[model samples]
Target: MPQKKLPRLRGMDNVREDEELEQFGDSASLFVRDAININFTSAGRAELRQEMKLATDQALRCLWQSPLHKDCFAALGSYWCKVDAETWQIEQLIECGPGDVFHIVLNNMICMACDEGLFVYDGSQAKRLTIDTPAKPNATDAGDGSLPASDYSLAISWVANGLESALSEIDQVSLSKNSSINLQFPMCLDPNVSHVRVYMTEPGGGELQQAIELNIATRSVMIANLPELGRAAQFQYLSPMKTGNFLREWRGRLWAVRSNVLYFSEAMSYHLTDERYNFIQFPQRIRFIEPVDGGIWVGLADHVAFLRGQDVRSMSIERKASRAPMYGSSTLLHSDMIKELSQGGTWCAVWLAENGFVSGTAEGQLVELQYKSIKGISAESCQLVGFADRLVSVVN
Candidate 1:
């Protein structure tokens, strides 16, 4: 006697009832209501989800596990925390505004983004990168050295480690007689600021050149005979990076997003941005962004917009999807594991859409798997992580 074969359900389609699903009964199901804590095996069979719980009492909003970093990072109730990657020991890195923390690696360090602002974690604590510009230096006349004095323009920038703030307002000094210009720098209150850089125009010159770099403690300096001048002011009109929730390093530039606008840091300079030229505006809120080989994938409120090219100004943008993906739902596939699943396409940005799992490629190509499998699902925030050949999506 031949045993009756039961159909294997591949996905759920609540939009279609049993009568409507009869034609596809060998593939789909009309109901999947009680599948909590259950996962589908590779063979399309359901089983209990295998999970190992990490012990921690602090409510964590988000975590970034990085191969470049020895310690993992977490957002624990308005504080950034460092967790021992192996021992899971928790240590508060620093206090920040309460919100989800997003991360990216740039300048050989971990950059964290949250509601508060953009920050980078030094080994000791989280150091904030400032957007505030230094105030213009006060220009006055001191006795001359050798050259006759004309008009002078002075500006200053604050520096902390490798980061530099925006240039201050230009202060013009007019000298009727032969005199050296005495410039007084403003007092710096931020503890992260280490020194102040002064830029001045050579005796009547229009181009502001680097005059001197002084410790924040030294309040003023009198210039007599100018020593060898440094390079011209590069960021005279540039501003520091604005606050963004999602940040990624792509194509030698750091990209960040908040609300509906996407900002990219200036070329070669990772801390400054010219908003006029280094930003893109999406019609809707950006949910997620991922770096591809030559371009990036942007998940918006109801569509996936794929931007292709090396440069931001000339990149071609194309609309990929019409449905909303769960916020923060992007799971970056490992480079080697990309070939393990059916081996057809090298998928990078895989997200949980309203329909099912969709994999996008570096070439702006998209391949969908298990379409209509998990229908009518949405979440405010979903963290998708890949582990041990398994994709885990946690909805918060």
Candidate 2:
């Protein structure tokens, strides 16, 4: 056949797939899987490099900026250390076990939960919180136990006896004038027999006396007319049957979650009393609870929820519909994954999901960043930390 002039191909822009592809350039931001390095002035995508190195042999568990020391604290396998000017300074704050999990920060201290018990650590020292519990009655003793437990009054007394055994002591509990104290039990307490006893020490080495106007309830106690300035006040109440796994401070209150129940401490006080605290139950097992934006983001076993102003709303990514109480994708998130669940900015928070990464804004918008180039990145294996303008994620 006679030779015909062929049209010249300007560039390989239309080649979507190529086996022999080499150099590529585009004005749009490109996501890639492989790592590369280009000229600093060139607008090309490149793999992230390690900006700073941590000096430690043990695996790093968590990192946070300490407001007191004005440095970063790294929680390694068995101990924690302070990182300043890129130098890892080991600190013997607390001996953490395998199951130990750092909970939250309050009053310039960090709270940790471990198999032994709950512990609090300042920059210099660590103290294990004493869990006050009343003596358990002997089950075999049958004086009142032999009587029929059917009469209403007798039933009430029996309940009181049971509560006496379950009483938990509140240590170092203090209150201000006209303020209330909230107590959180490990489990719900019986309102019939549960009551709070507040012991206040008078000024100048005076005797300790119980305060009045106590409002007792199932899980909390409220005491009004607290002395303005007493030597100190202590509280005791029925012990909680269970201890919470996580603790955080939000909206002027201390929050703790055990299983599906959420407990709130009295406003502006850390004391959890039967009359002072409130609770909310969820349908599914709670995986994580964090304060995001001005509200709280609750990650359930299958989905996520948002609580704001006494109202709770479920979030899903499937529903693109606007004007809903919560706005987000309906993608199923991995509940067990606990990495980078914190605020990314003033308006948004970042967290890991089953498939990829996600971010939720204060306006109730959830976004998924699942670029194919970064598909191999596992959120579960990464520890995320936020800085002024960037987020640093360390992968295992």
Candidate 3:
């Protein structure tokens, strides 16, 4: 008598209902039309998945867990939670309402994204990421200065801590010959602002050049003489990144995605983005962007493209044959932590795709896990959270 081997299961696929799927336990496998109330572990053991008691009346969406502390953060209907993962303790609760929210934790900084705008929580309070620009300056002809008679425009930007905000509205003024313009700037309502960077046009409509940097408390400045103008105000070509989805940090720069455009911040700077020169456009919509050791894994609409280079501008895109990734379904998994559960787990980015779960290694090699027996064909979006402790795949 021969020993009987059971049939192994590959993930579900309803698209090819008429075609026979892979069968057998070794080289091929079969798929269930639907997997209900059970999950199979890596050793091919089917464990019962039961519904447990809810801690809260409602559910938490867009959940993110911190690896260092093992705590979790989630968004309730209109609130935010700081939870202890092991004990499931709601340590802190915040009231942040009315829009879809996404959370990101970079080092000590934890930021939340919503329809209203972007905000950062400093372990206590969540503050919106905005700094008011100093208002247009009021100009008068009643001044004794070296400013010659010329029509000029003055632009100013606010600086909080070391972050320089977007340039303010330009205020134009006509100066009579030998007469100076006395400019007075209104007090900025944003308390975080500490300094103001001002730029002015030269006589006879010259280029806007760096004029002077004054403390925010200094309301008035007499344009006595234009000293050697510093560097040109090239920052005028840039804008602040107020809101974006898929916010990620890569190579000392902030990367965000909107539509089909991937916008990048200045090196080591987060607030400012030069969209004209600091963006990568794709024909298809971007689902996720994950920064890896030597490159990035970009999940596009219907394919997965690996960018193979440290420099984003020069990175080469290598598209492979694979099922499309679901929207916003990517999560970071550590090799050491994953090794406890399964095999061949490296420090790579994992995302749910139409076929199954796709993992992109830092070396730009792609390995897909298609034996999960989950149907991703009909799912428009999937929720992947707490991958370190437990893999929660909620098809939405």
Q: How many pairs of residues collide in each model?
A: 0, 22, 2
Which stretches of model 2 miss by more than 4 angstroms? 1-30, 33-54, 71-89, 129-246, 257-263, 271-279, 310-345, 369-382, 394-396
The 10-residue segment of model 1 with minimum total lDDT is 25-34
Candidate 1, residues 16-131, lDDT tens digits: the string is 55565534533543334336677666565777777768666657667777667556899887788888766777888777678778887766677887777778875666777655
Q: Which candidate should be chosen as best, given lDDT against the real structure?
A: 1
Ordered from best to worst lDDT, the candidate numbers read 1, 3, 2
Q: Encode model 2's per-residue lDDT on 1-396: one tens digit a residue.
A: 899532222222222334323333443233223333321113342335445654655565555565456656555666644555355556656665654354566667766554445556766666554333432211111222222222110000112312222233323332222233333323424333444333433322244444331334443333232344333233334233223655666766666677788776544434333433367778866655666544666666556666654322232322222111111212123222323333343545555555345655554556554322223333323455554334445544
Q: Candidate 1: where are CA atoms >4 Å away? A: 1-34, 51-54, 85-88, 334-347
lDDT (tens digit, per residue) of candidate 3 on 187-295: 7887778888888888766678888888989888777776567887766756776466787778887777777888787776666776678888888999888888868
lDDT value, candidate 3, whole model: 0.72
Give every collision pair in model 1: none
Question: Which candidate should be chosen as best, given TM-score against the real structure?
Answer: 1
